[model samples]
Target: MADLFVAGGIVTALEDAAVAVGRLDAALAGNPLRRAWTFWSELDAARRHAGADGRKVDLFRLAAHLHGLPLRLGDTASAPERGREIAGLNYAIELRSWMAAPDREQQRLRDIALDSLRDCGGGQPALVATAQGMLEWLAGQGSRPAIRAAVPLYLRDRGITIHRLAAVTGGDSLRAGPVDPDGFTVRFLETVGREAAEGRDLLLTMEREWRQARLRVDHRAGARSNSRLPAAVDLLAASPLLSISALAEALGCSVEGASRMLEALVQLEVAAEVTGRTGRGARRLYGLKRLLPIRAETTAVQRRARGGPRGRPKRVLIAPFAELADDAGVADATPDAEPAEPTRLTAASFDFDALDRLIAAADERTRGVRRLLDRIARGDKPFPTADGTEEPGAA
Candidate 1:
């Protein structure tokens, strides 16, 4: 809770988390091993839920940096490692998507990531290998309609280690393996693990319902599957966050036609415009309801426009290490330095005092969140009433 609050711009959360963890750390001071274990578990949960790692493309770039693998955005002569690592990460992520796809295709992509990992050389070889192992395990699994997710692999210098993530519940798994003990590894594990069952059901359910939605569209609009709008639905179902330009090209129609089809879906409540760009020439993205993050944070950039506190909360971007990897001259940035600490994820570098304060704020929010949850449990809504009074009262 503290990590989420802190990540979401709630300083109280950080203070609260620090305090809570400090107390726990002190309590378990007698047992050093247990203390470390608990600390790592709690910390990992926070980062994973907050998605500190980032999206698939973000992860590719992140891994390349963390492991000292170079990636270029130019046409200049790039090192062989740069291209190999980038290609490897891309294929690795693709393998995760194929976990629920056809078996033959999944195997094909799995081999690509493995071979790429083998070829690329730089820092954090163990981390790269561990990630490869996880992807290999997932690719080898039976074709069950599971949620597509990214798994964190430790790329720290020394040894390769995968996170040994347990199932959030029974029968939800992505081939278990050895894991690196850290504050952030478990966060990634639980985020993906807890969603495993739901993702499976969601994929299966969508497979059935999306087909029904398509059939309904065909029946009502009298459009064939191969037609502009109908064909585009297939693409939307596959990759929900689609652009007007991409849809237009896929449908072989004008961009206006693509926009029209999307608008039609919006009217039917089958899709929603995530970015509210309205100009004909402006950039935009459309996504299905299922693709949106569950209980997503309302960023400061998204003001209420109506009634609400207008205070800006600071948002923290997780930079695992210093400016060493982000440099364009990553190849010559610095001699590969083995991390001194255990890759502690408090990106702000919290000392004991800062952690305690952050955790204190977190404790208060924790109680507040619990109260809100209790209200929800009692069948109350978390919105305002007609009079704009906030409470668990009648709407």
Candidate 2:
């Protein structure tokens, strides 16, 4: 009965996956993540309610399970693809989410995808192997194809090449021949669509964050006599990463002047050189975090804090989790301290009236911090979160 139940679960997963892929166009057209996050949040809630099922499903696991479901269902006898799909989905989504995902994550997922593709080449059951092959090829999975197609169009815009990708493609090991495979283009388009939606959502998430962090291209506009330099600044706000030649074309300036302008941007910290150049014939790329493929959210805030009309902005220090004490202002004894019965924090659990009083006793500026937090708590202001959304009153 347990086996049958598990089999039924497998079937349900497969059908859901099929339904998702079939309706992916609509998913692409509307919000890509609305369905994705809702599905996992509900699944996780269900898991928590089921007492024994403490295991939580994160976005990565849920995406992998759903995206690679068709492949897993193809091989009931030897369904290793269940695990493999986790890697594939992780790779796909990470590429979508992060402009610069960690090196280890990139290598780990890429190796899994490559090995899985290679393994499926040998003779396998007809029905089982077809979906697996599609998984491997992912449209053009096993066969070597154009390397550019394998990379996101955004990355290609950054001037990806055989050498440039060596470091950024996730792993140190290099595979010769075509880096991109078939159907990779379609996969990338889907990923790009999702990425675009994510970027916009991130920008709109925090009104304060967006208002504070907008790269001020106009700061240098009046100082420069040349009209092209002002145009160049506008271009950077729209597209933060561009090649030297691309910048030249956009600015309608000579390469030497373009190089100078690019350097000026580097000095402004509005852009930075991303590639190392040799003596001659070296192509370089410059990037800013303000545009698509968004990087740090604190760029504008940090810049203003450093050079604002007011000397330096006051820094707020929140106690780290490690330093947080129990309700009675007591913590577990360390090895150096005498052991005592661990006390529970009772009064600290319910109301924060005492905490409010403590804050009220602080200096005027410090007390202002509480007012800011209270405003945040009441949904009166917007603040940024790590996941690119506003938690309204989470302050």
Candidate 3:
């Protein structure tokens, strides 16, 4: 019975994979990345729910990272300025939504979509679409020939090389030459709706190359950081407007150490040399901003964060297992028995007034800090957050 259960699970998994692959193949064929924020939006949702199942899958996470590629690579904002950049982009997305929604009823969904966009800030959609494209390839649906017909169109629009496309997109890997016996050729052809084998070879050629290209892109994006840069770089890059002195204070580091890192950044071109001067002093300070063609840095980080194409995202993936189990019971003679501990996935929902109070306190503290900064910018002399008493600034 246990063996049968496991076997049933295997069959179900294969079916799911095939379904996912078909969806991806359709996406690639149509270049659904053209769907105006659809790719990033879905990728964002997938990322949130990828680990909702418990076991991690690399494809979903990769999809999430890939969704942010456009803004990351193309935007002029510093990495730290990502929030502001994202805020601006989100406003634009909302504005577009507001303009495009045809009916008042659809407007609510559009608003929800806009809110989601605001929450995620900005990211790469191409990479996300590619990752998803690969997953859908595995699901083995409809006809492979139809899917094949779509591939060229898909690859052409996305600028996806065949090699890279195959590698990172997940599936049983393939090689060049006469099709291997245990290969995906016939299955792929069948899935895409191609009856003749002439296009079969050509489609396989494209598929193999696309996989290789994706592999190379994924590899280059995930190179190790040789330098000992702080993890704060990632956090700060996400919040770019922070001043060096402010960052030093936040990180509890000496001002000079922070300056040295900034110097390194200037050299690497991750940040441009900006001239910041004290009104009363000649001391020039340094800050970092993301380099142009922001795609390069953002793509790499997205790839890394998704744990490549093989590993899963860090979040939870919630497959509808309960629904599946009940359905499975009807399909098989052996009724699905409950596990020893119940293996509960859904947590009990409850209110937390105390937690709300704590959150309120934190909000108050943030407001206080903002007020203090405002005061400092004014002629108010004394600096707060200092030891002993507030020290007056130089006249």
Encode model 3's per-residue lDDT on 64-150: one tens digit a residue: 122222222345656766654443333322222222221353345434433332332224233233223433442533222222223
| Model 1 segments more than 4 A misplaced | 1-196, 223-226, 292-395
Worst 10 residues of 2 by lDDT: 164-173
| Greater-TM-score candidate between 2 and 3 | 2
- Model 3 local distance difference test score: 0.32
Kindly list the per-residue Cα lDDT of model 2 for residues 7-123, writing each as its tens digit.
232344334332333332232232312222222222222222221222232332332232221221233634565555434443333233222222444445544444543455345
Whole-model lDDT, model 1: 0.38
The most accurate candidate by TM-score is: 1
- The TM-score, computed over Cα atoms with residue i paired to residue i, of candidate 2 is 0.27
Q: What is the C-alpha lDDT of each candidate?
A: 0.38, 0.34, 0.32
Candidate 1 lDDT over 1-395, as tens digits, reads 12211133223333433233233323233321222232223222322322322312333243222222233343463778455544444343333223222245445554554444444323322332333344444456622222122122112112221222211111122234334323233333333334333322233344443555455566656744355554555556544246677677655678888889988876666665544444666555665544332112122123232465564322234432112222265456446552121221121211233233323433343344434444655887655466756654221
Give the 10-residue window scoring lowest on summed lDDT in candidate 1. 161-170
